[model samples]
Target: MFTLSSEDNTNFTELLKAVHKIGSKTIAKHAQDVDQKARFPVESFAAIKSLNLMSAYVPVKLGGMGLNVEQISKICEVLALYCGSTAMIYSMHKIQVACIVHHCMQVDYFKNYVKKLVSEQRLIASATTEIGTGGDLLSSFCAVKESDGQFTLTKKAPVISYGEAADDLMLTARRNIDAPNSDQVGILLTKEQFQLEPISGWDTLGFRGTCSSGFIVTASASIAQVNPVPFSEILSQTMHPFAHITWASLWSGICTDAIDNARKFVKNSVRRNPDMPPISSIRLAEVTGSLNNMRNNISASIKEYTEMLIIGDSDAFTNFGFSTRINNLKISSSQMLIDIVGKAMMICGISSYRNDSELSLCRHIRDAYGASLMVNNDRILMHNATLVVMHKEAR
Candidate 1:
């Protein structure tokens, strides 16, 4: 499904096998507790960090695995089957790595930082969504202030997924005080360089393990910490596609687990009464079909996006049609997860609803809801609507 050298393909296969082992042995054991406590999946991440998977997306030349987005998406899918929060945190970290690898690594400072990240197995967090921005990612309320080759940025973000646990933060802000809010630059700041003031708690409906709370972030860094490429280019070329694809992959994993549980419930019922098939057997079939459709949608997008990235189609990435298509993929995928989970719940009946039942889907359903609200599906639709009105047909 993806192009890779023989050695990399072998390595990718081995890495995937390792992730599956970790998911079942470590992540699955802690999933329920993580959800109940609304805390970070420390044990699952300890297992992940032990394997140094944090740098899985980085290039082999940079002393890392050099896995592509598709490969990484598969890893997220695997992790999510055991624990959605662990999968989400892993995917978000890789998204930041993708942005830097694609856009900022050309600069010596970021290049060295990538190597450092690989060596240290450092976790990176994102701070793109800010307060008073109405969840608008392109604009920033904070600006980077520079002085004598040093710079400081103060940003109040509504949520920084797993921020407290991260070793570094990949943040976005206005280029300077005089620049427009949309003229933003991406910056990398280590824990030593930034101070975080917790403004809100992380008690949420789903994705509780993410620890995504509001924070007032004040960061100081060398001017060299800023990426040379503009945030808009980075957003279009790497961040948008990487984030949507990985996120969709993880959601599919969560839904797949729920379906599996529902299937198990049906099988158990059939064993008890061989005379007639359980009514939910039909629902299991229906949801399975929907699951396939959801997976195929995600696979097709991964293939298309991977091909464009391989060929370095920067213009295509930024095009209105491409952006709309990616945004729609997110919207559809998010809705499909909710639909799949709801159906699975219906199939398992009270068993799925009861938190004590082994076939329970309460956790999966809650996590599925996070899909639509994370970025808000309506916001994407409205943005695409504007793009559609402005997009011109190619002759």
Candidate 2:
């Protein structure tokens, strides 16, 4: 049964232990370097793969441990506490696996691939978001054309996490040739067949290590075979909630880390001066409390959202409600993290601002701010939520 509480639960305990072993020190040491150079965290991915963490979402039927969303969320939180970019990349791969499992009825090749991923410890990454389409992931500027029972695609993905290094890419593209607003989207995988066309446009302020560079794909390359049914499902349902929960979990971890650093700094200051400012101490406590509150709220939201998804009502309105809640949580968590980090910076003074601190409160503040802006912007999401409510009320 592979119970989490059981001492002999090798998969559960080992997964946690592997995350700590692979992520803790290496992420702390290289996070700044990766951010500064805007390089992908290759070593972190290597470590994660070594622990078979990348295959966590592959179902038990497919020979994977098949952990649930809550378990995966915990693992993500642990990793994000060390490095946000690494966590984001890793989460995306997991989402890819979940998408594959949920959508396909024929499991022969999919199960084989899952077993191979676990045995070989290979990583898969999503190559979805594009430059021209903005955040409308459903409509990709990329398109797939079929000839002689084979498919080829021409794509220009703007931000593919682990784009340069992944073993395989699960990409989305429009299939219809004539219709501009085609609902027939195809999800395809490309092995080592494609080349990374030179992309000179990857300078970002935060989560720099994401290596979120753009690439152009030509039709000459052979597209790896993919099952479109699961792929499309991934785009609509699995990807969105997975993204929300993963990012929210990361933000929660970062918030906790910031609170811990702030507490340590305050304690040190008080030790140095028998009478540190009373207001400083009070503010630290308040920030800590606020962070805790945000964590609880996000955790609860994730639980509720997951339950809704598992209940499996395919009503369009129900899906919107789930997505709206997820979006709100992301916004709320980002704000809380910003507040905590900003206060910590004030408390820790110029030292926290310096690049040498293991905590890197300044970098986190910037990263958190950027995350809040990406995909569905917090302000826009709030507006959408209001409209949804209004539409429901009128009905």
Candidate 3:
């Protein structure tokens, strides 16, 4: 059994140390090349799995670490700083494991799966987002009907991470075949039992190495288990927090990366040209402070939300609180990093844009654009907030 090293201290610190020791050293350096070639970071994944970090959140009774969400978020934040693609892959796996641990009816199967994942260093990811559905899992147009206790999931999931590499995929589909527009749905686990013909390639401007490809599910497979309730409720209640924290951590890591690169550029410029303007020094301080503030806010929010989850108060509404906060943080971090990177580019002049500088703020900018598009976008979140305030006023 993997015992978490931190008994009295915050688990986040320990998680950071573990990732550092697990050989995530060249993740950032390799990120550009991987993104350029659209190749998966196989070495990084292998290193993470070898350290059993992939099974960090599975219950210890199941021969896993059983760490909490706060710990997992810390590890994710660290990984994101190095490689956004690797961080995303790991986050999806963690979300799937958390869902199974909390909702699976077959306890034996769940335990055995965790054991196998830990022992064999296997990974799982989500294939829930559909191309036509517009990234909303609750409002998926994908249909799954019950015919002799077997469910067939048919949908075109675009931008699914690790589409061909995942050991299993947590897929969501609507059960209301008679009513195609109804929100009644359930989650089903599909093992490596289907084909993943890449319908669309993943040559994106950012997060390129994520291997987020579009594929179609053509065959009917055995349904592992269903939530026994509406899928929307399960997603809003159980899955939202996982998504929020994971993505928030990723953005936070990217913010750190931007800051580090900016600092290096400024420091080198100052070293070479000692007579540089004081404004450059002031701008560097401002950007560094902004990045630090965003990182602290995200880390604190993850800790608070994790406590709520562990205490069993993770209902849809309560979970939304953390979700909204994370969303806000994502937006703020992206904007800040973009401005900081732009300033850094000016400081470094044409050299920053050169291929040899290895300073690709372009990828970060694109990935940041996609971040705001995740789940509830800015307008939707604002509307939700308005509804809440109006409800409180009526009360």
Candidate 4:
């Protein structure tokens, strides 16, 4: 589905196999507890870190495996099947890495930081949301107050996913004290560079292991710590596409697991009756069709996006058509996951509702619902509508 040379395919397959092994042996075991406790998935993430998969998004020349988005994506999908929380945390981490790799290469400071990440297998978190911005991630209420080649920032972040677990975060703020609220910059900070006093809880319906708590973030770094590119540019060129696709891939994994369970239940029922396929088989086929549609939609977007990236389409990031398409893929994937998982729940009946049932989908059903609300689908739709009104056709 994703284009890769023959040798690349072979290596990708082996890497995926290794990730699946960790998922099955480690992540799957801790999945339920992680959900039940609403705490960090220490065991699962530890195993992944041990495998040195944390740096897969870093270039091989910089000490990583040099895998592209598709390879990291497949690995994310595999992890999701075992534990949604682990998968989400992993996906967000890679998104931060993608932004850095794509936009920060020209800066020696960030270049060295990338190599440091690969060497230490460091975990990176994101701090994009602000309390005063009302969830307007593009606007910042704080700015880098600089002095003598040094800078300090005091940001009230409304949500910092996996903040306690990560060693570093790419924090977004205004470019300078005099800059407009919409003028943004990203800075790299480690534990030493920042003080995070967690001020929120993480209890939620799905992806609980992410541990997304609010924090009063205070940090300072050298002037060199700032990436020269604007935050909006980085979002349009790298962060947006990487985040949506990787997140969709993980959601697809949740859908795949639910469908497989439904298949098992329906097949077993038919075997027991031995008269004909159960009436539920119809619904099974219907949901399976939706699942296939969802997967293909995601895959095609990845392929098209990758092609544009490879061809160096200068306007690819800002093209209204491409942006609308990306938004649609996110909307479709989010909606389909809920539809597919809901049908799977109905097919299995009482058993699937029980936590002890082998076909239990309570976790999956809960996790699937996170899709639409995570980034607020209505916000995305409204943004696309405005773009549609202004987009000129290629006449």
TM-score of each: 0.96, 0.87, 0.84, 0.96
Candidate 3 structure quality by residue, lDDT tens digits, 262-335: 67777776788888754567777876777677767677767666555555553533444445665566566556
The worst-scoring run of ten residues by lDDT in candidate 4 lies at 1-10
Q: Per-residue lDDT for 291-352 in model 1, tens only?
A: 89988988998988888876775788888888888898899999999999999999889999
* Candidate 2 backbone clash number: 0
Ranking by TM-score: 1, 4, 2, 3
| Per-residue lDDT of candidate 2, residues 1-25 (tens digit) | 0111211234687678778777776
Task: Write down the RMSD of candidate 2 (Cα, Å).
Answer: 3.8
Runs with alpha carbons beyond 4 Å of true place in candidate 1: 1-7, 390-395
The numbered model that scores best in lDDT is 1
| Cα lDDT tens digits for candidate 4, 1-395 | 11222123457777788888889999999999999998889998888888778888776667777787777788888899999999999999999988888788888998999888887888999999999787777899899999999999999987899899889988999999999999999899888899998888888898888899999999988989998688887887778888889999999899889988999999999999979889889989999999889878878888877776677655667788888888888888999989999999899998889999999999999888888998889999998889989886568
Instruction: Tell me the lDDT of candidate 1.
Output: 0.90
**lDDT (C-alpha, whole model) for all candidates:** 0.90, 0.69, 0.67, 0.86
Clashing pairs for predicted structure model 1, backbone only: none
Q: Candidate 3 vs candidate 4: which has greater TM-score?
A: 4
C-alpha root-mean-square deviation, each candidate = 2.3, 3.8, 4.0, 2.6
